[model samples]
Target: MTETAAEATGTAAPGTTAEPRTTAELAPGVVIPLIGLGTWPMAGGEATGAVARAIANGYRHIDTAENYNNEEAVGEGIRRSGIDRGDLFLTTKFNRQWHGRTAVREAFGAATRRLGTEYLDLFLIHWPNPSQGRFVEAAEGLTRLAEEGLIRCWGVSNFKPAHLRELQAAGLEVPVNQVQIDPETQQPDQLAFHRGHGIVTAAYSPLGRNGSFLSAPVVTGPGAEYDRTPAQVVLRWQVQSGRVAIPKSADDRRQRENLDVFGFALTEAEMAGIDALDTGAPPRLDSDEFGH
Candidate 1:
């Protein structure tokens, strides 16, 4: 594993901006950016502008999903950024309605067309609808897509350790696992499980969506000491703790501020402080019962 951006750079210099950096490698050719722009509950022109602005401000990774209903806007934003397709790492998910082998292929095609790209940097199954009992079939579909060169890598979201083990038992390989992770919903066990399996854990809602976690002294004290916002402190904790964080912000200033986390390093004590804030309960929807 490579050193995190903060670990490599020491402390951030005042008024200095750092380049986007990769925090983990999913495979031989697939390197995931430490921070990515998460697009959910954002759509149409708003999503387009936010994505374009984020890319212009040094965000190379963009995470969207079929259920987000903004693939077109995301694609347009990528176009507006004027950055080459090869330089960006784009990820989108297959809708739950599109499970099973055939549906997976169809959904992927539609997503690529909406995303306006020939191939996706990474693609995922948005949810594991276990009740449907088609996740394995969907995984097989994604495998075919990968072998067909339609997607560079494939994985799952909202998957528990047992769910991952199930897929593994089916002889499938998952490179990434996107899940809701935050100080309040720490998921240390899940993180450990992913690391044990060589899977990259992508954290959604890393800042706790309701913004309540920002008030924790563990977060605020670190922000005050580092001259960073609570959001920055939380995102920094994610990167430093070795997880890919996709924080959603439509404002250009906030987007730029979020990407600026690489300038400083969080102390072991501070990291432990934040770790102590975990309530051990997930902040949002539970995967097993969700999207069923």
Candidate 2:
């Protein structure tokens, strides 16, 4: 049976949440929750505890990376959550050093060991380090892993249109691309390119740091109309607009709040209002010059 947005967003347990009911299919049988818990700038017991807390609150999709230096902690949280590994979607990324065809496999092995998982749901090439010029080879390696059943699917992160074009020219299939996107720094041209290529775009840092539009009436108006928080309104606008959002929050209440967005949606006008807040500023990090 198909699940309704409201049904999917409902918390599965009292004071606990269910996975986001809504999802974006990256490949056949490979679905990603529209809203995921982002684990960046978090580590050690703090990372482990936050991840466990999120799971207890019904967050089924978790995002982390080797660069985050918290995979072991994230893995610990997963064990503590006690949720079946099959029921949750875990995603992580590899760094530039592992940008070789075979090196990508080594990276995957190391990630699984630290994450304490047999296989990953989705793995990403953290950045397309153009100067190193091995991201394509890395992509090839990830694809091989997927074929061998090591990972469910693979894609790239921080890859701009030019980078993606190069991958395409090499005949690589990019199932997903995670990048920094928010209402304030929306990348229209980049998004258009993804749409044209059938690549799913997942937004990391989905909420701009202290986004100016959070208080704008366009957003607040909808929050009032829907009896939701400004952040919820923004997130609702995000998922409704067809982009996956991974907003980070270690606070229990905030994590729950972020997951609760699927219960309500914004109107066309309200969405457009938020979309108009784009400052046309470039992303915080330029993939061309910055990556590790």
Candidate 3:
């Protein structure tokens, strides 16, 4: 395998801003920005402006979902930025109601229309919906869509190792898997499975929600030494560990801070220190029983 962005690290003079062009190739000819803007829990005008400002701040990757109910706003933000659509990486996922070969296409068309885009950089099944038991067919649908050139790449979210094994057994390939990962709730087993299968791990909620752990000595110690915020320390660790991180922030300064991580590299000890913070708790939402 070619060296993934996650395996590589770069440095800049401390306290200076570095342009974030780091990306991981999830599949042939499909490269995703390592740091992306996650648009969820934001809607309407808020979503639009956050996305627009994110692009203006040099974010080239944007993540949204059909369930987010804000693809229209995200698309508008893209237009407002006046950047070429081809220059950005846009990702979205659909609910289980759209699970199936033909229904997946319907969902794709609807998402593109809502986002006002010609095609997507990546499309994902939001959850396995294992009880529904049609995710294999859904994965097949996304695969067919990719073959048809409707999407550059396709993947799944919140899928555990067992769910991925099913796809493997069905003779399907998963190029990427987005799940929750942070210093706490590291999901090492899922990540190990992804690495063993050459699947890229995309971390949603890269920062813990109600993240009291940011104040932990392990994280804050690095922040002080690197002249970065505690959140930046965690994001840097995520990147150094070879995972893609999409952190959400509607505030311009916070967005810029999120992107400023590439300039500083973390030491192995610091990396381990943060890694030691993993609580081994299951992800907040279980794909087995909880999926839209």
TM-score of each: 0.92, 0.93, 0.95
Q: Model 3 segments beyond 4 Å from truth?
A: 1-5, 8-21
Give the per-residue lDDT of model 3 (tens digit) for 101-220.
Answer: 899999999999999998999999999999999999999999999999999999999999999999999999788899999999999999989989888899999998989889999999
- Please give the lDDT score at residue 194 for candidate 1: 80
Order the candidates by lDDT, highest first: 3, 2, 1
Strongest candidate by lDDT: 3
Of 1 and 2, which scores higher on lDDT?
2
lDDT of each: 0.85, 0.86, 0.90
RMSD of 1: 3.0
Model 2 residue 196 distance off true place after TM-score fit, in angstroms = 0.9
Report the Cα RMSD per candidate. 3.0, 4.6, 2.2
lDDT of 1 at 251: 95
User: How much is the lDDT of residue 103 in candidate 3?
Assistant: 96
lDDT against true structure, model 2: 0.86
What is the clash count for each candidate, in the order shown? 1, 2, 1
Off by over 4 Å in 2: 1-21
lDDT tens digits by residue: candidate 2, 14-91: 222345458767777787898999999899999999999999999989999999999999999999989999999999
Name the 10 consecutive residues with the lowest summed lDDT in model 2.
Answer: 1-10
